[model samples]
Target: MSASSAKVRTITRIAMFAAVLAVCSQIAIPLPSGVPVTLQTFAVGLVGYALGAKRGPLAVLVWCAVGLVGAPVFSNFMGGPAVLFGKTGGFIYGFLPMALLCGLAAEKELPGRIFLSAAGLLLCHLCGVLQFSLLTGMDLLKSALLVSLPYLVKDLISMALAERFAAALRRIPAFAHTKC
Candidate 1:
């Protein structure tokens, strides 16, 4: 492919992932606990790992912007400025930096390793929990115990599974240009 065509193809792929992320956000499985663990984050982490630093965060930015526009593109089909300002707002906004940080870690020479990806996801969880507590007036420790800890195993498994899935996707003709 020509250089410009390759670039366009790459952008198209990133946009596709962003759309997927938005859709994933809408499919929420409400937990008994106040925190609903959505598969959207799994897509966020996967985008970071699969698209590398630059395109990955760009994809997330697109997803977030779409969600902010009252698109019902978030967990529980929630969106709009109110959603951004709501108790879980921080976690929603936090996804940007989290995805970027994880993407950077997943793209860096040493940082892009699987271990770093895992660690980056852990940090994302921490940031989300802390922000969640601050927004909800809950204790940080309590937030961690209630919201973050329970999701640890699941997130780890999801990240690992995403890594594997991304690897396989990269081998496909259509997704060949995606960086995994």
Candidate 2:
């Protein structure tokens, strides 16, 4: 394929991942703790594995930028700086680094991918808990127990599923040009 063709393909894939994150944000299951369960973690892991370090986080940035600009692309169709600066903002903020971490792991085998992805998830949770505590004036550990623990369990499974799906996606002809 020509270099331009590859560039276009890469841009298209990044755009698609951004859309995927937006759509995933809409698939939220609200919890009593005010943080909803969404497919975003799964999508984040998929973006990392499929696009690798450079491109994965780029896609996440695109999604974040759109959301911050008043697009109704966040959880519950919320958007704008209000959502970004809200109590759960740190979790959203953390997605960038999480994708980066996951992308770095994409160069490795499945076991390595899982390990790195787990570490990335931990970072994401840490951000969320920290923000939650700061915004709510709650203890960090209490915030984690109240919000992070439940979601962590679900996100762990989602990320593993994302890894498997990315592996399968890599084999498809359509994704032939996507970075590992």
Candidate 3:
């Protein structure tokens, strides 16, 4: 491919993954604590392995920027600056590091990948717990109990599935021969 085309391809992929994340975020089941069960984590995890460390985070950043600018790209189709800095904002911001860490997982063997991905999810949960606690005036333990703990198993499963899906994506012709 020409240099310009390659750049276009990269941009297109990033935008596409950002859209994927937006769609995933919208698949939310709202709860009493204001946290929602969504495929956002699954898609973020997929982005890391599918796009690699650098590009995955770029895609996530794009999604975040869109939402921050008032696009309805967050859970339950809600968005804007309010979502970015609101009750569950920590988890939203956490997606950055989450993608980065999961991207790093893509470089490892199966065990290491799972470990890193789990760690990344833990980090994301920690960010959520802290923010949820502070914003809601709940105790840290209570926030964790309510939001983080309940989701660990499901989120881990999502990460594993994301790895498989990413592997499948890598088998596609466009991804097979390209360094990007």
Q: lDDT tens digits, residues 1-180, model 1?
A: 798998888879778999889877877778876568888668988888778777888898887788788888878888788877776676666666667666776666773466667766777777778777888788989888888898888887877777777767768877775454
Question: Could you tell me the lDDT of residue 21 within candidate 3?
Answer: 98
Ranking by lDDT: 2, 3, 1
TM-score of 1: 0.87
TM-scores for all predictions: 0.87, 0.95, 0.95
Which model, 1 or 2, shows the larger lDDT?
A: 2
Off by over 4 Å in 2: none
TM-score computed on alpha carbons, candidate 3: 0.95
Off by over 4 Å in 3: 109-111
Query: How would you encode candidate 2's per-residue C-alpha lDDT over 17-77 as one tens digit per residue?
Result: 9999999999999888999989999999999888888999999999999999999989999
- Candidate 2, residue 168: CA error in Å? 0.8
For each candidate, the alpha-carbon lDDT, in order, equals 0.76, 0.89, 0.88
